[model samples]
Target chain A: MSNTISALPGATYEGAVRVQEMGLCGMISLRGDHGDEKLISAIKDIMGTVMPGQREIVHQDERAAAWMSPDELLLLLPYADVRDALTRLETALAGTHFLAVNVSDARAVFRLHGGSAREVIAKLCPVDMSPGAFGPGQIRRTRMAQIPAAFWMPDEDSVHVVCFRSVAQYAFDLLKQSAHPQAGVGLYA
Target chain B: MMILTCPCCGVTGEETEFHQGGEAHLTRFGPGSSETEFHDYLFSKENPKGVHLERWRHAYGCGKWFIAARNTVTLEVYGTYAAQTTEPPQDIKDTLSAKVPGWSWREFA
Candidate 1:
């Protein structure tokens, strides 16, 4: 059997902020009516977290559920547990109008660490990156430079970003360039 | 830089985050309709200089379609609402009425 590999596996860059590729994250794209009792309970049972509100992300340990849209969610868990989770979701949602598919390999995740982490992201995205505006638990699906990406802060000093696997290199380079040690804009500082 | 708010997720963002879908509240004139009606439905569009209603997609955000009542000339946005609506809501109409008196478009006034 072939071992799974992450896009830009083991890549790391240290600039104003530290950027590292988060390898092999299991992600499930679940689409359905958010108001449906069956859908909500199934997600709660599988992810051990309640459905997140709009633009919100709920995380417990390695499990998380992020609201992608009114009828869509992005569930994160251990890569190896994706198969079992999908099966459980399917069985729980049988005959229900929903879509639960493993998207672990289709996307890439990067972690940015350091006090200037928000500034690095702010340079690329149009979102308000100030501490008062964008803090922990808030997830934003927006354009990073030119690619479709989503990011959320785990705390004041760390951010987790997800983008398409095809653009992993571009995303990494963008982060690295924006985080250049001497390029600090001091806007978020 | 035009700013827009996605009614689906309530995220206010720049125009780059949303995709303009041209005219809004378009009524389809499908088969059995006259050629003129079909042509108007497909090709003809209201290019009003003021108080224009349009469709916008939150392409980089929630990926939901919404409606916007904007002024092309003044770049004033009256309001945004869910795309499931058939026409601009009453509050939007009231706002537009207060701003541009005697303004009417298509079947709305």
Candidate 2:
């Protein structure tokens, strides 16, 4: 049997920050009315936590969920638990105006951290990367350089970013180049 | 780079974070409408040189659609509002009118 490989072959660094792939996480896209009592309860039962606030993330045990939009969320779980989560979510939201799609293989996640992680992200993303503007628990969808991506901060010094699987390598290269400490001087600046 | 705020998520980001949806508050012309009305709806644009109202989607943010009142010439933004409404809010129109004389969008003079 062919074995699965991580989108990123190995860890790399540009400046003070280290960039690495967070491989094979189960990513499920969920959409429903936040105000629906049943839906909220169902999610809580499955996640052991309520839906996160807009642009926020709710962490419980090893599971985490990020508010992807007003009525959408990106649920992250252990790759082994993906099927169970999907079945539970489907059964929970059965007939409602909801959509639960498993997008496990559609994305590649990258983790970046260090003192200059914010600067590296700022160089690639137009969104405010300041601690005051965006910090821990906040998630946002935006573009990295030229490709569409989403990012969230699990803490002040670390950022987790996701992009489509097809352009994972391209995005990784762009991030690596942008994360270069020397690249931020006169020429690229 | 112009900064556009998404009403839904309360995220303010550069124009690159949002996608321009062109002119807003358009009146759609359907099968029963006159040919001119349909043509106007399909092709006619205000294309104002000054203050303009437009639709924008925070495609990279909350992914919510919003309306923005801005000046094309100076790139000054007046305000951003939720996209659920069919017309520009009165406050936005008043702000534009106060900022630039005789400013109007269709009939909201």
- Top-scoring candidate (lDDT): 1
| Candidate 2 residue-wise lDDT, A7-91, digit = tens | 7757566565788878887889988998888778887988887878888888888788888888988998887788899899888
Point out the worst 10-residue segment of candidate 2 chain A by lDDT: A180-189
Instruction: Give per-residue CA lDDT, model 1, range A21-77, as digits (tens).
Output: 999999999999999999889988999998899999999889999999999999999
List runs of model 2 lying over 4 Å from the truth.
A181-189
Model 1: residues with Cα > 4 Å off, grouped in runs: none
lDDT of 2 at A68: 83
Deviation of model 1 at A25, angstroms: 0.5
**Fraction of true contacts reproduced, model 2?**
0.89
Query: For every model shown, what is its TM-score relative to the native structure?
Result: 0.98, 0.93
User: What's the true lDDT of residue A163 in model 1?
Assistant: 98
Q: Lowest-lDDT window of 10 residues in candidate 2 chain B?
A: B100-109
In Å, residue A160's CA in model 2 sits off its true spot by: 0.8
DockQ by candidate, in order: 0.90, 0.75
Candidate 2 collision pairs: A141-B60
lDDT of 1: 0.94
RMSD of each: 0.8, 2.6
